[model samples]
Target chain A: MAKHDKDATFVGDSRISAKRIPNIAPSYSEFPGKSEPFWPNFLLKEWMVAAVCLVGYLLLTVSHPSPLTDKANPNDTSFVPLPDWYFLFLYQMLKYPWASGDWVVFGTIIFPGVAFTALVLAPWLDAGKDRRPKKRPVATGIMLLSLIGIFYLTWAANDEHSRLHPSNGGHSAGGATAPAAPAEKADSSFKPDAVWTAQTSCQGCHGVNMEGVAGPNLQKVGSKLDANQIADIIKNGKGGMPPGMFQGSDDDLKKLAEYMASLK
Target chain B: MLQKMYDWVDERLNITPMWRDLADHEVPEHVNPAHHFSAFVYCFGGLTFFITVIQILSGMFLTMYYVPDIINAYESVKYLQNEVAFGVIVRGMHHWGASLVIVMMFLHTLRVFFTGAYKKPRELNWVVGMLIFFVMLGLGFTGYLLPWDNTAYFATKVGLEIANSVPVIGPYAKALLTGGDIVGAQTLSRFFAIHVFFLPGALLGLLGAHFVMIRAQGISGPL
Candidate 1:
């Protein structure tokens, strides 16, 4: 090793330490520097994650209570947009250039997949000269591009700058304004032509011709109950339903409920 | 009987004074824990610790009402939220924190890549990180299914179908994930087992090794 330094004396920067890899035995270890805890040395990494997982699980159970609905309510649409926060990234993704179907899914799902794939393949990809990042242009370029890609998609999903977040985190005076248009859209589902189109998603699951797969058949559901009961089943949700029946709008629930009743 | 066995083993062991009795050596000045790579590891690792801790605290409370079986899974979640103290917020924190973990892991991996940290000596560690990444993804998959809600049910079904779409190993992977066919009792059990036992167990060792390797190798600097 000392001899190499002597040989490289002719080269300009002798501090070209690629890495101090050992060339022996079947295996080796790669531990980093020994540092005390970031704080007063109380909790370590694993313990912290373990703690968070425990707490999060507790909270979720407390708020929603598992098995709250029965039988995975397919016909019921009473529930609202209560997606898991982890999914909000994608849920938010759905709003992205949503009019363009393929690009939307790509921005949300496929893009992340490709980026993670690249991360996995990084070792095989950039196997080149110097050790420091300063020496590696190609590798650096890829990382910057990836960061930009993620930022773009995330922004595209929830353009907080848009009407979505008018207050920049402050509560809107009424906040009623946010869901009005969407609510009206839901109400539009009740129109005769709209009823035919909207009920198909229900038909695909509950029964196209009137039966049940994951939900009860809706052949004569309207005669059995009034608007409110049907609305509860549609909006607040029922057994086996995903609570997607209505999203922050009674108008949508009315539309959905009326349509389901019309199925007979 | 166990106490006697312990005593017998202790008597046979010659290890008494331990490392403190042997010698003490001070670390070099440059070998601070906050070295570039060490700081780098600390950044993500510290975040993982924070997130996992939140998961643990929230999960314990959830278990109060979280029935592992399919029959009551949805109901229990509702009960916890409506009945348990601070249940909704805690659950939300856990959930939002999960998304945070995935994001942090991605950034950490990127840091490792651009810095050339996974070169010759650190190849295997990089592989371990990859495994960690996949395990996290699996965590998302199985955890989502546990809710048994519509989005969870349908999305997971989509995910399972995708898994099953693989030409040769599709069925096997699907079965392994679902524990059987659809998201029934068997599937729920399988996911719970993976989420609680298998993934955490695997991660413990991987995480330790990952940190130790980071310590041993020293962090790679900025690209």
Candidate 2:
């Protein structure tokens, strides 16, 4: 039994025997010399680059202006809602006529879903030994194709959104055609902040339906005061309510008050 | 004075060995700054960290005045844009910084992929990187809804509607995200919670892991 045990250990050792070693490639060692030290060599250089980026970002912030739109109005169906540019590719994909009918789920789910899953599994799938680009055609090709597809889809989505919602023309980065000629202007009765104000500020105290909770029922507020008086109460705050809880322009406050007075 | 201070700390912590260990990393000397692609990866990594700092700072400032309610959300943003001092610039920094950070991340991923850096020992790093990319995308989506403008509302509506189409657990997923069948106060609150707390928390933790992974397995060499 002791002799058998000795033989077994020897066999295990023989499997990883050093006798068949291959010559190490000279390029693996000779192609690149030793690295520099960390502090001044790497960290200082990184700091210098970060400083440049900081300056550049500061300049960008000083120059570019951010966009803001009218308050949210769920009832306004004319408002063409668009997402940030990063999501434009997916948005454009969803607009494909083939995907639009009953197969909308394919565009929204299967396409993105499959792409993400494939991306995660790519390294495992393409585990070729060679590292050279020419030797690794599959990985390089996929990367190039994905890059082109994403950019093209993003451009297409932005173009479509601009064509549809030309009222937002000024903010469209490069594509400049005239605003859509027939887009109807919203009239005076269109209070964009009506439901918004009621839900956000009033709903908490006046109940979800504005029938009153902690505060008096605003259901018949129009019968009690004029739009101007109501606007004053909103701007000044009343009873337990804090002052200027409705933080908007004076004009927005007036519109909201008008919206409230008209509710009854 | 600085040397003495270092000595004082080093006596207790033995940081001299740690510093030596960090500085003694074996790298391919051919990894020069003249290699624009590699330099870009390094520069953008730094820039991404810087931009995240900017985002956090600017976002905190915005949160101070910006109301997240359905009614006051848009109005608060408008007020920030028009009424407050330098509010437009702060907001603009965050907006443009978000775009730049996303673009940089894509470029960094491309650099890594083309160079075959995700092979062998570095596979886990690539997976972590992919996680970072998706998390950043989530951050963008959740943050988009906080303003509660028509664009934000409708865009989110479209997005949630897409979520509603998944084969199984579709409705449950939609309800989970929007907090109900419709986008309202509950939806706004939930999105705010995610944008400010959950996503950021996950991002910081993941970022720490990512940096440690890179430090463990130094930058991959050129092909």
Candidate 3:
């Protein structure tokens, strides 16, 4: 193949502006001294990386299965919310004293908005042709600082979460945790009737085994509230518990209330 | 037989040149990992793409069992996890792959930035890649609410509240997202649509643009 002259003058057409086109660096325009076919060489390496990742992902899946907490309870206000690990940095940012209350938009919107915009416009923001990190002090410094900020914020978020709920175990960096098993203090001899089985939604706050979670301990609730009182609470909103949570008919609610009343 | 099949297709479709263009293209040594240890960083982008493919596949399988309504959503996910064959593995792949793809994409962005590969003519590609990154994040947000579990519920509630904290359009955005005063059946349905259809479609288009730009411009020169 004939080598093109590096400095060859190009004529511009009427439709296209010659000056508008950015000059391609020699490293990009000129053919490299050593090159290989993209097929077997580069693609082979890509496939290797992919294979390793897939295998590792499979191992992770089998070993630490994805967690499923109790079904969603819109009424459960006591449950603390934690975003996934990737969003922890942003979550942590919102907790900063300056970013809370009236100034939340700074952390919630402005900061993230500006950062994303800057990221998208990075190439134009740093328009120099110098590819070496050592030559681009400002760009390199910003990159390092941004990285440190993200890591630090994520760490702080995780630390705060663990501090708040030490018994739930520290937030898993992998974003997977074992299912939160209900406390094992329920009456084992209590047989679940049809009403109890149908009311799975109760488990969200009342606990899977009815030993209670965010809700008051219901293991022996029959010792206090009778079937009628329990039914009333289920119908009318009580402290922190939203009303009309029971989706069943009045008869079904009555049976569920009686069953709960019999728990003791 | 394979050779004959290839020749037959090449004769009719003129595929030989296309195959040659794809398979015989020269990769500059600077971008070739075999040539420089530093080029290993290039693998992050490809790995991110690989995980995205996994996510798409796993997500598709999940839809076979996933219900978008408030009533059946949790129950369906529970059924899929406990009953369906390989359900756990499939769900797990999508779960883990979501986080991994973000990590890989972030590392890829850092690599591109630090290497100064996003300069001049490559600026648009950087923008497209950034859009893809945001789409990936959007995918994560929408997918998080699908399980309808306690954590999903409260976490999404918090996320929406954060959106509601924005000025001017904040309350509107939250209303649009939640479809009402609260996160309910409509919210789940809307998020399901966005996660499975809208965002994925946008991601695919952006990815195509990103890849085409890379091919047209070729990989950036070594630092």
Candidate 4:
């Protein structure tokens, strides 16, 4: 290293003169034409934009509010499941005839996988100096086509959902129903006991109102199986129902069994 | 008084120059809205990051009350929404913030692509950004199941089935995600741990790399 001049004023503890070395690159040295300070110059605008976003976010929260629906019931085959809006395009793609059954991978994996891989490799895929969309026709065209495809798929998904469940008022993605609305009961007068409410896991295979879905209708089960038989079946899984599905203690199981037997 | 305190800390830590370096840095004029109205497009990335910060803060508050089990998960969310003060607001912020962040990220990606910012020296940054995007999607997917609602259960069922549709590792991947033959307690626990811990950690690390790369490359030149 060359000896520093005795009178040279260094920056901090460095031997190099503070004025000798430029802090930024040559391209950035002349700030007036191409750049500005990041602090008050740029950050002030950022703060303002952030404030607007915050206000808009608050308004959206207050207006619609987040939704909370009924607790999960694995046995509820009647319920139509829908993913959030962002995933809606892919969800719709899986419904295509070619994408179903044996070709399911085309929609779920292959197509999406290819698209994502292309996106990851986009920098190299269209490695050219031209930045303007007009100059980069291929890249721009591909982007536009993809956007159109996604938008169309999303719209179709919403349309299909509405067609399936017209009463649902069309695609309630964000507007989920309120929590714990009592599921429709077969016999309105017959009230559900505490055991029934707590052990709702039974509703997974059995119907929400014990009217039967995948399982046999238990509304008149007492006429078919006695309490002991029902308890036996509950303890040891019967037919399609899996073993140890009922998670409560033996006493709760007995009560549930007895309750099932009395449903007639 | 504040200046004196800052001076004392700066003297001990030798931080003034560092602070000045950061606070007085120059950003390309094209990124400034005053330079051109089109420059507003650059705001999307910063907005995404801003919403992400809000998400982290609100998500922390949610964890205080959220229970990650089959039995209590739904009920706990209910209690928080109905009973806890400002709980609805916090939860709502997170809920809406998730959607907003994705929207902003998509817009940011579009802006970058249109401007050809992903070309050449900035290619690595683009890859890192895409990783961050996928992590954000992962976060959205995992967080969707946290409430343990009927919609969540069946939607997740559909998602897992899609995973299972893949040829070779499909079944195994589904089994790992489900944690068993079914999407029950184990699945809930797995998703909860992943949503709260694994993906967020990955997201932060990726985001840090993304920012450092952007700083190093000094934002791509104008179109």
Best model number under lDDT: 4
The local lDDT score (0 to 100) that residue B201 gets in candidate 2 is: 91
Off by over 4 Å in 2: A1-31, A174-264, B17-28, B34-38
DockQ of each: 0.14, 0.30, 0.44, 0.49
Q: Estimate the TM-score of every prediction.
A: 0.55, 0.72, 0.78, 0.78
What TM-score does chain A reach in every model? 0.32, 0.53, 0.59, 0.58
- Candidate 1 residue lDDT tens string, A93-123: 4455751255644644465667667677777
- lDDT for A116 (candidate 4): 92
What is candidate 4's lDDT per residue for B12-55, written digit by digit as tens?
55565566656766888878887887899999999999999999
Each model's lDDT: 0.56, 0.72, 0.82, 0.82
* Worst lDDT 10-window in candidate 3 chain A: A16-25
- Candidate 1's residue-wise lDDT over B41-67, tens digit each? 435655665566666676666667778
Query: For model 2, what is the C-alpha lDDT against the true structure?
Result: 0.72
lDDT per residue for candidate 2 within A1-264, as digits (tens), equals 445322122233343222322222222333345555454465676677778877887787676576555567786454566777888888788888866668887887888888888787778877987777778887788778887999998988877766554555523652222233332221324333444444465554455555554455666678778898898888777654656567667777777788778765
* Model 3 CA deviation exceeding 4 Å by range: A1-34, A178-264, B1-4
lDDT of 3 by residue, B1-223 (tens): 9978975554445565455555656778776677787887888999999999999999989999998999999999999999999999999898888989998999999889888989978999999998998899999999999999988999999999998888889999999889999899999999999999999999999999998898788888666
Candidate with top DockQ is 4
Candidates 2 and 3: which is better by DockQ?
A: 3
TM-score of 1: 0.55
TM-score of chain B of each: 0.78, 0.90, 0.94, 0.95
lDDT: which is higher, 2 or 3? 3
